[model samples]
Target: MKQFLILAIIVLSIAQIVARPVEYSDGNDDVLAPEPEPTEIPIGKYLLFTTKANWIEATKQCRSKNMKLISILSEEDNDNVVKVIKAAGEGRIGFWTSGNRRKTNGVYFWGNEKKITYTNWEAGKPDNVRSNNGEEEQCIEIMGLNILKWNYRFCSNELYFICEEPHESIDETQPISLLFAQQILTVQMFGYYENNENEEVLTPEPEPEPLYDLVKKYHIFTTRVSWADAMRHCQSEGLQLVNILSKEDNDNVIQAIKDANQGEIGFWTSGSRTNNNGTYVWGNGQPLTFTDWENGVPDNLHAHTGYGQEECIELKGYHILKWNDHLCSYRLYYICEENTKQNLFSK
Candidate 1:
């Protein structure tokens, strides 16, 4: 009877083990999965202030931070700024840059006294439109409208601003651990993912080529002619009047002229404000993205009697290839750019 009781007890224990529900978890219940790291704006090398302040106050704030107002000297710098602004989720807001023309109207320069070589101006911007109280729109801001473009606003207007660390303070020989931290932050902010330890990592896609090459060949015409005549001649030769769009293009044109043994002589470019509402544009109707104007130029001065408005652009060798506004009827040598592959193939 005792043996039978022992067998029944064993059977009961077996039945309990089989019938009871077994809870299985990958430590999700007892051990909380580490709270995810909160998303933050990747500042990189910039300091973004969400609070609004006037241009003067913004400059003071940046100075207090031991930094300076942001100066975007290249397209990459501008893109990084846009990314930070977008991350902040501010729509239709403008941010103050270091650009200001308060010292000399219509001549924008950064805090470092460097002329703004790269520009992304909005249509009809930097108009220098005066306010009702006669306040000039001399301060530049990056507008977050349809696209990230620049617009000059009243210096007293309150707006968000960006500040940049001085290049001298940046140490390229940072510790490896700091670099790893930066990489992790980048992965988190940019949505980069990693494979599991056992899984094979996929290769990244190659970056796309730039839309246009910065370098271009040019054809210099030594014959002096009016801007209108130069345009006609270039069109007849299956080329377009050279449109200097960037510093690289300007340097290339200067070198090309030197290669032709041309001395320090002025050359007419495709830029002109003739009948364009006081704005300059290339013969192809494209707006100017870059400019190298000399000090106190484009003054629209009627230097010569009986000459029309100073509506044409000339690369004056006297100014070391700086641009100057001259009368359209003034005869000068010109440059013509080769037809692009797309243009040639299309023709």
Candidate 2:
């Protein structure tokens, strides 16, 4: 009976060995395998996407994950997001945020139309720098050596992004022994599991969105054309030449011009004089009560010679956005106003 018991014990031991879990190791033969690192570290209510993309592209990509691009609403939220980016070994690359301009010279509103009560612009940022032919920096991006500073850039520029969704319930029954292994596996499945230094992202970023909704519904025609042709172009598109009726209106228009970063070139408005000595009238005939002519401008001088025939008004963006008089036949960039009546804040 003792010999029989010994034989049974040996059989059981052999079976246990066959059914045991395989030992995990780094394959160094000397060191045991370390616990797997988590694929995602909970930071605030977001998951920082390590993949890079433009602002518009990032927005759609995040939405596909049932999340939205990270909108830094407060200092606390900003710090939390920065932490997550760092943990992902992506602090060096900046992430796209949800802030964008609603109107030219207008305050930036978040994607959900949240007021920008909090901002962390890098010193002298949101500069809206648009070179002579460069595009406007309308989209906000969080990029710096430290990963918290921010600056505005053209929405088409590509960069890493963060996506935030409501946190789901955590499973309390999960064993601690399996947590690390699951994390590593989950990250690997994301196709972005980079061992940090060797991280290789395999998943492609979300697709791009059209550039229409990223800015105000206004259009700036960089093509120089005679005032008559400019008016015709606007009419063709159901638009009209811009009419600056008030200081606020002028501010908005000038902001658009600056945002275009088309340099200090001239843009024709709807104001023009019937004759050199007659009053200037808006294209819409609203009234000639408002004017933004530069000091000593509308001199109505025809090229500094001959009769005073500078009949049309052009806003020179480079000259402190001041207005000047030019021949109606002179070619220049123009602003077109659409007839859409939607509320600006509806988005």
Candidate 3:
């Protein structure tokens, strides 16, 4: 009877083990499972304190919730926070950011003492005490009037503020089940398993090819024409006279000309003198912050015998792509700017 009881006990233990769920670890290389969806944060990830408070009080408010006032570290992050603020429906209202100054004429620092590497200050902003405004304008605020631009404000000034908190991210490098691994492999071999009900079918737009299959964002017009005539032609062609915004833009323009199999020929750019006589501005009404003026250029001398003021600039392509003042009516090769985002081939 005792022997029979022992056998029955062993059988009961085995049944219990069979009924329980089975767990396994292959001890293989640490492979990552698919990441779970991110958890949503309250106040839509970034919270805004609409209540008015001094900078010190604002810091406290954020610290109370284990968060810091928003630290914009990247352009993408800045844009995303701006979107969140817009969604908050605050119509053209300014709010405090985390950038602050501790000493006069000192660099601003983040609230959490993180290094400040990125800034999107408005034009002529952070001009502390420029108009004898108190030197105490050490705190930074996002001026809604300028749209995602920062400005210096007095720390004592009561204003709304933004805050951010850390979120827990799960480690995706955890092992997945053999069945899931097999399914993933199958999907990789084939295409993704699609459900027609969930997948929206739509025709994709055709990509626009570069001009002459050579340069992107620009078309070189080898046809000689005066600056005014070139501008008119570009307008008629839904283009604009080239505006060299940076060194990269300058290089690309030169490359486009070369790609067109054109030799070094001075091309008329949109750069022209303003009524101020001295101040030059781009055709797009942008400031002349960048320039590639040739040596002793804009001497404003007229062609042959210095008859009239040279009010226009031309890309002296043969002379190292340097710019020289030229008569607007002088005939020369020119380049036209293309809007790359548009499909030029679209019907």
lDDT of 3 by residue, 244-334 (tens): 7667678888787777776577888988883546778778766565677888887877745667667777888674678889888788998
Using lDDT as the measure, the top candidate is: 1
Model 3: lDDT equals: 0.66
Candidates 1 and 3, the one with greater lDDT? 1
lDDT of 1 at 115: 55
lDDT of 2 by residue, 1-347 (tens): 99999999999999999987566678788876646555434466787766667776677676666677777788987788777777666667678887776432255756654547788888888787763223466778888566478788776667878778733432222111100100111111111346678954334234322222313256899999988888889989888898876675788888888788864679988888754357777787555555777899878778579654788888875746788888889889999986443211123
| CA-only RMSD, every prediction | 26.2, 21.6, 23.1
Model 2's C-alpha root-mean-square deviation from the true structure amounts to: 21.6
Cα displacement (Å) at residue 336, model 1: 0.2
Question: What's the count of clashing pairs in each model shown?
Answer: 0, 2, 0
lDDT of 1 by residue, 1-347 (tens): 99999999999999999986655556667854534433323377778877788776676677677777787778887888888787777637688887876232244566544557788899898787765434567778998563668998877678888888866643322110100100111110111235776653323333312112123569998889999999999999998899876576788888888888874778999999986999998787767767889788988877556556899999886536788998889889999998442211011
Question: Candidate 1 has what TM-score?
Answer: 0.38
Regions more than 4 Å wrong, model 1: 1-215, 303-306, 342-347
> What's the lDDT of the predicted structure labeled candidate 2?
0.67
Query: CA lDDT of each candidate?
Result: 0.70, 0.67, 0.66
